[model samples]
Target: MNYMISIIIPVFNRKEYTRECLLSLGKQTDQRFKVVIVDDGSTDGTEDMLRQEFPEVEVLKGSGSLFWTAGVNMGIRHALKQGAQLIMTMNNDVVTDEHLIEKMYYWHEQKPEALLGALELDANTQQPIFGGERLNWLLNTIEEVLPTLPKDEQKGLHAVTHLPGRGLLIPRVVIEKIGLFDQDRFPHYIADYDYTHTARRAGFELYVNYDARLLTYPEESGERQIRSDKNFKNYYKHLFDLKGGGNLRDFTRFTLKNCPAPYIPFHLANGYTRRLFGYFLK
Candidate 1:
């Protein structure tokens, strides 16, 4: 079968953001790509804009409350059915380089067995964002506490652990072999982590292509801290339970041996003790 690239953007009441994302796609140097826009029950003007302005874009309407995972799944299925060789699930609030699609597709063709292809995501300042790291719980916690360093310090060429879905490209074979994102464990946060780890277990590589770049709103400001809400915490708890490899016993064993204590208190002291315990124990 001939190959086509599919770019899927999940929209949730972000009409302007969706428009910008689509515009970026339309501006791609590679025009042989199909766009699948999954409107996850957006009441905003997203639907109308797609119908009127973007007739070439495929629009998938949600039944009702479709979160990130479900929305991405919807698009993935559609893209696969449309004979997509490469699938990219990105956020609505992102702008891609004109050459982004072609670069990503080249890497996918080169590394046909890769689990995921990641681009170096930049903030408005065009700084490189870290895609993935083999982080223990303690290191991850410390990373959260440290102030944002210069982008150059964070830049490197390496095989990363997780590929952020914000601008990820997945080979069709990986999707067929390993399957889609785990919506049950992750409706939103950390779905990419679960997907990448699953692929790693299956012996597929995870990579970052610095040449393929895009600008994303990386939750840099106060928005970095999601609002304090029980629903959000519930989402995270579900994420851990669904994503964790083992129980508290396993987590303790994994952490004490691999994780450092200094970073734990440094980054996550403000987190609730119960949350910390659950994360550490689980």
Candidate 2:
């Protein structure tokens, strides 16, 4: 049978998380999708384990330099070559709901032109983590959509300007239009944000489907902190760290690509100010 959807995942050394994620996919009610797991230089025997346990999955090899954007791009290229009608991009750390694909398909059927972003919940708290978001360029901030509302009340489709890359479903047509991610500018973080904004600019609508959800672990605490032991070194390292937005350089690139002319300076200043204050307080 021809696969209707191709699920693309970019993974590193997290074998346990990848295993659980694949297990969840195995339980998905809709079996019409194919999975493409891009192993980006995993030293933890991820490839061996996948071959033994999940032989049916197509495993694409990647050098560590590919990061998130390039790794997913490789998988997307393969999926497109295979003639996939739809593509789903996701992280290896998420355990998806069994009906996620089914619901996403239903939503896509309703609005075939829109990019569908799944609602993500915290694995420990089961509370909404990220669903839909709006970018406040003036304030240089991103606001969560209906964050305070109860989960049940957050049901239905919401049009959003910003969507997380954690779980995004895109039609093949949209990919053909927007093209692949910019790995040089955004190696890891914010690449998803950039892509969504590009799609919106290209006249593709973005939607968040509350019914399609996944459970993801919270980001590591203290990952963004500047250590006091080696103050200068740590501060410098933090400035270029991928998790905390990768310093002023990455922010500058993001602003130039996404922000309006008048707002670029404000965005850059706001980002630098936040990082400076955050480092001092740490």
Candidate 3:
């Protein structure tokens, strides 16, 4: 049977997280989807585990250099070759709702040209983490918008300017027009934002399907009360690490490529100043 949806996931050494993510996908209410997992040179026995346990999943191999963007691109190409009607990119760290695929398919049926994003919720607390985001072009910053609708609010699609790739669904037609993620400029981070921006520029609408939700764990740092580390050098090194998507160089590249010409310098200056301070300021 032809697959209606192809779920593409890029993973590294997170064996446990990958297992849980695959388990969640296996439990999805709609089983009309095929899973394409790209293991980016994971030496942690991730490949062996998937082969033994999730044998039906198509595992794509990647060199250590692919990172996130290239890994996802590999999976996308495989999915396209398999004749997937819709391609969904998801992080291996997330546990999706059982109805997530069903809801995504339903929403796509309603708006075929729209890119669908899932409502991400905190896995531990089960609270809504983020719905969608709006870009502040003036400050060259993206702000997360948490929908404050009532508990009984009707479940429907909401328009969004920026959608994270954590659980993004795109119809095959959108990819044909907007193309895949920019692996060169944004090999790790900012590729999601760039792709969504490109989709919007191509006249494709973006929407968050409230009914399709996924659970994600919060990042160790950022707003979650950072721990004081005496080793400032190591701290700074990790903070500016290109793999984690916090480096000033990558940020400057992303800003200059996507942001307005006049605001590029300000965006770079502001980001650099923030990195210099080493502490997030309110």
Candidate 4:
């Protein structure tokens, strides 16, 4: 039988974080998956370290800076060409639980219609980082309020609207149906959301495996954290408008109401709005 899954990891100059990420992959309990690391031109010894430590992972070479979407596309293309039926794109900074692959695969097997399946990512300090959420209005992104303790330490399952790309698993069928990620609109940030939204529109579902878990490093997170940066809001507002069309206005409002105050809507709004005006000015 073909490989059940391919874990695609795209790395840049962040070898420090990539090291931990690779180690966690090494510790996975499921062995039905192959690890493919796409090094997007790292001058900071990331390539050397991967050569030494993760020789087994298929390494794809790229220029130093292809951005997140491009790098992910490279890795995904390689995985598909190598005969993987499923692809899991993970961030280089996060380390996952051992049963992550097994749980995710089970979810996919049971629910093949789930186009995007993600795990709950916690802060390195074990704080709740991302587990998907209902869109918020004011913040304009998914909210992560309380830390949803580790799987072995958790109770019941929780549902969410979108999946986090940091540890997201996508089946080959879904990718074929929806097409690969859009490289034009998003070089980073919100691109995953755009991809998921497209898949959802195409009759696919997005979900979270409450039992699958991972850890990340989030510098900005806390209660009553007010991050209404005009610059950030304006930039992303224009980005969404250009890509998502006028629907972005309402979409932005939807995001703000669902996402946390400091993270979503505001920051993305600034970025999208700025890009929109810049386009006309030029």
Q: Which ten residues in a row have the lowest lDDT in candidate 1?
A: 221-230
Count of clashes, each model = 1, 0, 0, 37
Candidate order by lDDT, highest to lowest? 2, 3, 4, 1
Q: Write the per-residue lDDT of candidate 4 for residues 1-282, one digit (tens) a residue.
A: 346678888877879888888788778888788888888888899888988987887889988667678889999998888777888888887778888777777677777767544445555466555656655445444455235455464422354556657788888888899888867656555667767766766777776666678777654321012122335444444344332222355445435543455677466666466545643443
- Which 10 consecutive positions of candidate 2 have the poorest summed lDDT? 220-229
RMSD of model 3 against the true structure: 2.7
Between candidates 1 and 2, which one is better according to lDDT? 2
Judged by lDDT, which candidate is best?
Answer: 2
| Each model's Cα RMSD | 7.0, 2.5, 2.7, 7.8
Top candidate (TM-score)? 2
For model 1, state the Cα shift of residue 110 in Å. 2.0
lDDT for position 55 in model 2: 95
Arrange candidates by TM-score, descending: 2, 3, 1, 4
TM-score of 3: 0.90
Better of 3 and 4 by lDDT: 3
| RMSD to native, candidate 4 | 7.8
**What's the lDDT of the predicted structure labeled candidate 1?**
0.67
Tens digits of per-residue lDDT, candidate 1, 231-256, equal 54543543344322222332333333
C-alpha lDDT (0 to 100) for residue 86 of candidate 2: 90
Tell me which residue pairs clash in candidate 1. Answer: 248-281
**Candidate 3, 127-219: lDDT as tens digits:** 887888788778666665565566666267878886888889988899999789999988887789889988987899998888999999877
